[model samples]
Target: MVFVTAGALDGPLLTATLRLRADHAPPGTRSRVFAVGAGLEITAATSGTALAGAAAGLPAPVLLLAVAASHAVAGLLHPVLRGTARSPAALSEATSASRRVQ
Candidate 1:
């Protein structure tokens, strides 16, 4: 259950990061993608082991709260990973719609 929750929260963010890197990388260059994969692999291995160690002997509610807090921190960092905002055209459309609503 913890793995499933974490995966659901992380999958799309990781996918978006990969897609963004792929689109911006040089044509025919897969090095960036590989780098991202390697980083994720390393992070998962170390963090998973550490988390498991910490959660051991902890109360179930405490572990769940820790997981939720970690996800919340990840959520906060997601916007930075998202890079720039939408294009001016999209921004203008959004503004116009809001103006109409007002």
Candidate 2:
């Protein structure tokens, strides 16, 4: 049931992430950008699965805590990283740079 719920939630998140990536990718390099993004996602998932398999001997509580901590860290970092990328100056510079490239 938990796995099913997680999978259901993951679908929309993945869709939105891919859409966001596609929207921001430079015009001529959209395909390349998507390829790279997909490659990275695959690599991350594979690495995570491998890590979990290696850690299978750990206590369930420990494993669950580790997962929770990782999610907490990511949630905290998201705002900081996003703010940096979406700042007014950063956005203006990116826009001008993309315009210049065209």
**Local distance difference test, each candidate:** 0.78, 0.86
For model 2, give the 10-residue run with minimal summed lDDT: 83-92
Question: lDDT per residue, candidate 2, 5-94, as tens digits?
Answer: 999999999999988887677566789889999999999999999998999999999999999999999999999898767644565578
After superposition, the stretches of candidate 1 with alpha carbons farther than 4 Å from their true spots are 1-24, 84-102
* Best candidate according to TM-score: 2
Which RMSD values do the candidates have, in order?
A: 10.7, 3.1
What are the per-residue Cα lDDT tens digits for candidate 1 across 1-102? 999999899889879867866655544346965687779878988999997997799999999998899999999988987676565467557767877999
Model 2: residues with Cα > 4 Å off, grouped in runs? 1-7, 86-102
Q: What shift in Å separates residue 64 of candidate 1 from its native position after superposition?
A: 0.5
- What is the Å distance of residue 9 in model 2 from its true position? 3.4
| Backbone N/Cα/C clashes per model | 0, 0
